[model samples]
Target: MQMTKRSLPRATPEQVGIVAKQVIAFLDDVRKHESELHSFMLLRHGQVAAEGWWAPYTPELPHMLFSLSKSFTSTAIGMAVHEGIITLDDTVVSFFPDDLPGDVSEHLAAMQIRHLLMMGTGHDQDTMDALIAAEDGNWVRAFLELPVPHEPGTHFLYNTGATYMLSAILQKVSGRTLIDYLTPRLFEPLCIENPTWDICPRGINTGGFGLNVTTEDIAKFGQLYLQKGLWNGVRIIDEEWVNEATSKQISNGDGGDSDWAQGYGYQFWRCRHEIYRGDGAFGQFCIVMPEQDAVIAITAGTGDMQVILNSVWDHLLPGFLPDPVVTDESSVALSEYLAKLQLEVPQLRSESMLEAQVSGKRYEIEQDQMEQAPFPLKDFCIEFDTDSARLTLKLECEDSIILGREHWLSESTITIEGKDTRIAGSFTWKSEAELVLTLQAIETPFRVTLEVHFIDDAVTIHSRYNVGWDKVNTVHGRAVD
Candidate 1:
């Protein structure tokens, strides 16, 4: 049967066998506790029950998926297997005979495609750094050279390099990059268009990470699996493949009740309550709950991933009812609440005593002080208007001006590292002499805050990041007389 591809149907929470009041309470709990959650979509009975995107992280933008990319890579491999281009029992070195090391160990010789898919390549620790540091930038060759201490399939290691190798193998056999291979087979079938994946230096897609897609796209993927690879009425992928991929294939640890420790499938982590998820760093999640016939997709920038899952279990799980329970007042209130949801912008309303004094004054920092800085800002000046504000920054040899409003304002083009990026910004006066500006890169899971404090003759700039390599740092600057 040919299945029709269309947008997911929308339904009120009560119509989907969930209480509207409890749904609202779940959202409230998320806002109160999980402050880093950027966006989420809740689906039941193949319909969208509720959805929301935090301020600056809109549904139109594609958020970075990080390790969530692995599951997609695994799907591509499954497709290739179904096409007979490869098999799980195929030797890992068979596809890249030319790249194999001269003296392949017995463990390496015994490695199979199934071993990689199940994260049982036998390495004790992650070997991704060695692949990145390869002099020739050939990740496949570098990975094959690394020693596999334990025999393949005997040990379980959370290896991203193993996932990358799967990508390389698919490309070698299918004569297309992983993204290209999946475009027609997976993305097109699901009505997902123009998805992007990060590529390695050698032009292969980084299968272990770097996939970007909208939150709803994540929901669609989970829904596909929930339906056993059936989209609408057609079989996009074999049901057997979906069953095997999500089933527990390897025991990760004695994690007791921890979802991560339960077990691991092919590129998917088995969770408690008969759920499975494709998750990434900082809380990008696509959770499929078979028992509830529901799927929850999330994008966030929080370190506490377990807390997010716990919140779902505590609030959402209990809300699912066996029969629909409709209430007019609760449904209306829940709909209104979701429509008005927005991430609060941290600010203070006190009028600054030095607002007018330092409004347009330029301050210059010592050259030696900024030599090792990430931004290396040389001079900066702030200008404020009744409804808008402008911040002008002088870099090593160029100047950039950022314009924002007192409330969240969207920018279509904000240049960062020479690339145009979508950004939303807002500013407020924390005190008479201190101004705080928050800038969020909407397409990415990152935010940068700049706090500039004005003194008699000098200014202090403190910068912070939501998540990155940089730490909180202060730079001192003097008025550029």
Candidate 2:
């Protein structure tokens, strides 16, 4: 399934019938709304029309896809059906007879692969949390034991566990993991390189979430779907599969102005304007607008995901004309704007006399004393230089990173959530008594900010994320050195 020398063509926005002004407006709207987008790519007529990465987030890094992984999992199932390895009519329990509960209910017995595909697993609530908490670590068994209160394919619930079950079923029938099976079938065919997906304790890919790929990779996948499974005239997947997968298969909400109420497809969400998209938590999106022969891929760390889609509808949608527009200086202006896109870095507002007083001083925090601790480190120390500061964090092990005083210092290293990853950081003195430190995980859509107050012989640090949970967490410590 691997191909050679096949990449999406690049062109000016005018060449692709996209108005550069409107596209620029879209960018403006994003910033105006305070949406922290990491990267974006716009495609039309099978060519890349516009693309940009917010600095600190480069083109080469793989961003966490979160729930966007479900769409790829759905594609694997479609291929399995095409190859005769599995069928939509296949019973869920039939694939894992040994893992079934002691007494399967009628509703559980009737659950089908097609039901899982549509997120209609007959469970009234999301089963993922309970399944992962089963303690025994047998996810398959845990899923089967969960009560199915309704008939399969009747109720509509956004159940992630259904997608995991599909992955489990695919692995059981194919004797390979989701990634292994899709390597030759999807990833290799599309030239998606070295994608990483998290696995559960049982060694199965966590199909409902945990996928990472570059923004371009996501664009290519969306383009493939836009092309009806054809890549460079080669049929990577069946056209029929693409047609069915993106079409509405279940009603998820009341048809209103809200996009979430549109409908639900195989693993895609039916959108307004005759669009279907695969989206993830915190605004990762792969939106396919078939009517306009366009695709948009975006990654972000913003709490208000609706604002992103709203901006698209308000700005970008109007630019898609039936014919390509004439070349103009606006296209050049748009290019220049995209080339310079970058997130703001913290700048020093005042000189901190406290810097010289507390520099190289280690402050040890007692965990039991923290009113609200966002980080788990036991101690922290700061070393200041003319242009940058080095921060040392001591937990089970020691980690350090350098933060530029008024600019982002690249190529920094830190351990976040048990994973050692690259980071870019900046620091600024808010006043004579407080310091603000910012760290951005370059490979993920996450930025952590800490405001530290030095008072007498003690320090209080307040931490918060730009997206997701924004509540500030506070911890206090006494200087130990």
Candidate 3:
């Protein structure tokens, strides 16, 4: 299928029955609290009302979807079912007889494609570790060998392995990897170009995770489902499948006020106030609200996902008016605010009293100093030129120089945590004796901050990640020459 260029129409929030002031409030709330938010897009009536990306993260780059990939995998299975290539009731073992264990247990035999779709695999815990660690590297055979502790359809376990099994089954039946299979059908129709998914050792797509898509691509997905599988007046997926896939398939937990506790569909989670979402770890969300005819896509690295949803409920949900509201002063203000939205660079005075002492100085780290650091530290040097400043980091044998500037300066290559990555960094002096360096990995949603403190002839280094790790790594070094 030939791909066509498609773009969602743009609109002012008030033009689509949304309050611009409330949307601004929502963005402000997120800015104040959710420091790790990467990008966000809000669409109403098939038109983009607001969209913004935090600096260092842009709309063009494909952000890691994590578990949000499950929803896409589920959509593929739905399409396969529509085409009669497979059925929901098909026994999983039936597809891979050669890989099955010698004697399949009753629970394993009873498991069906539908069970995997709904995360109802009878396993009590996640099975990914075992699948990944399989000595022969045959994930299918490894999955089949594991014993099912409970009946397939009766248990509710958030299992990525189950989704992987679904992807494997799809490949076996269709003879195409999930990415290739969906390219012409789902991706091309939506204009999601050059999409990528991680593959297992056996060449199957990692169904439950490892999808990379832009925030707008994510919005298109949610909008597709909200439109009941129709895009630009064409039926991409069967309407019946969309309904079944988005509706509750299993009772994940007691229907609590928490969106997560509401229920589970086919790789989708039922949310509060009649909404459903596909979310990934650390906060990648594609939220669909049917009653309001709206979709929200967000990419973030925040620890508290609930706070994001709550802000939406409080700020955006109520702003959805029944009819378009008149353009007011607030609407104009919102447009300007959205235009100027940015993740500010850390502010610090340019000059430092210790600049002369640390300039062109090499420090040798003590052996005991390496214990507290994330990476083995051998030695480091700081240098400042008229145009830029740099810190040459020596970890064991590998050496990398991180550039620092008053503004964010993009570096094409830098090594962090032993991986070569493209990063943007800026330097600021917290005090005459302390220099702070902030480095953001452009491809991933993480930033590393290093604080270099000059105390007499000794230099102390402190390092921490913006999200994920809790503890700070510290190392001490003294001038070697």
Per-residue C-alpha lDDT of model 2 across residues 228-251, encoded as one tens digit per residue: 998877887788989999999999
For candidate 1, lDDT tens digit of each residue in 207-258? 9998988998899999999999998677778899999999999989886768
Off by over 4 Å in 3: 1-4, 356-382, 391-406, 414-420, 454-460, 475-481
RMSD of each: 2.5, 2.0, 3.2
Top model number, TM-score:
2
Looking at candidate 1, what is the lDDT of residue 448?
76
Clashing residue pairs found in predicted model 2: none
Better of 2 and 3 by lDDT: 2
| lDDT, candidate 2, at 89 | 94
Please give the TM-score that candidate 3 achieves against the real structure. 0.90
Estimate candidate 2's alpha-carbon lDDT, on a 0 to 1 scale. 0.88
